[model samples]
Target: MLRLDRVSAGYGRAQVLRDLSLEVKAGEILCLLGRNGAGKSTTMRAIMGLLPLMSGTIWLGERSLSALPAHEVPRAGVGYVPQGRRLFADLTVAQNLEIGLMARQSGPEVREQVLTLFPRLRDRLGQKAQTLSGGEQQMLAMARALCLRPEVLLLDEPTEGLQPSMIAAIREVITALRAEGVAVLLVEQRVDAVLEVADRVAFLENGQGGAVMSAEALRADRGLVDRYVGV
Candidate 1:
């Protein structure tokens, strides 16, 4: 559903992604694994149009997304949850979700679908987002993105600061989304959690591409995980 071809991007002269090519198929969950500073976040930003591409192309299905503006990318069915769970601290959970709805041109059933995916959000609809715990905030972030009814979701460091149980919860949600035909491109620090949800995995190294492997291959090969992802 999403494709990046020989894409290179970075801040100013410090290029972080060097000719990185990758694809996320529709209804599939593709996880990206890399050590810190391996350009995973940069790849995500380039695809979202937050960072200007120095070279190459990004496509959503058959449409070219490389030249589109950042705001337009969301409307084109790409949703991003950045490294930190960036939520409106003072806004109620419902209000934050409502902001996301601005991206959708259709999907009247958006709220119903998202609420079903995140039931914890229902009871806290009126509560301020900042008052929630780490896990709750993460759920709110994902829920807000889902409110857009995006076809492809890009999640960066999603389970970074959550408890094990929360990680498991998020994994279940990722699996459920895939079952429902949502394409997921995830950048995760926790290899095990990502492997649990990913259909395939790619490793990023030193601002360049590394290896692409089936989730099962990565799971069975402990040495590959250690060598590429620092396990």
Candidate 2:
């Protein structure tokens, strides 16, 4: 489980998140939906310790994520996939995954698990990341994060710009992760994807989180989406 309590963070003196609070429970997906500048990505950065918090705390169960250095946050069982698939472009798929394994000191067994999850990556192990297609690159990024065997996973726009088939593949993987008891915090613009995969949805407005409602509820009342995320 992961919890962000009244978290406020931003770049320099300009704050992006203002007292934002939300939680992701184990074995469930919590999708974050909002307009472009509602601080969705900022929430992920704060949780990853990529941005320093001005106030409040982020907790991974009993562990204080805000207290950890950016580098140490992943070691504490948090895996992140930023908006851009920030992979080592020149490295081979296997090599990129190796870096993730090294981060958690994971072994061959972990690599095997990741490869199994992303069978496409198995064949592309020796291929350079930069040479892969967008969908493949996204798969590599998610696979690398899974190598950490993370308890909490932060994924920002994982399905962005992918074909429908690829998006379905990514969604399937996320759903599988939830079944395996990983706490997922997903920042997604695709309402259909969120409705299919998320257990609950949290909307942000001006960097603050409103009430979290069940995915089923949102599906029943479509107006909520227009109100928070707009058309």
Models 1 onward score TM values of 0.97, 0.99
Candidate 1 Cα deviation (angstroms), residue 183: 1.1
lDDT of 2 by residue, 45-138 (tens): 9999999999999999999999999999999999999999899999999999999999989999999998888999999999999999999999
Which segments of candidate 1 are over 4 A away from where they belong? 106-108
The deviation in Å at residue 53 for candidate 1 is 0.3
Angstrom error of the Cα, residue 180, model 1: value is: 1.5
> Which window of ten consecutive residues has the lowest lDDT sum in model 1?
103-112
Best by lDDT: 2
Q: Give the whole-model CA lDDT for all candidates, comma-separated.
A: 0.89, 0.94
Please report the TM-score between candidate 2 and the true structure: 0.99
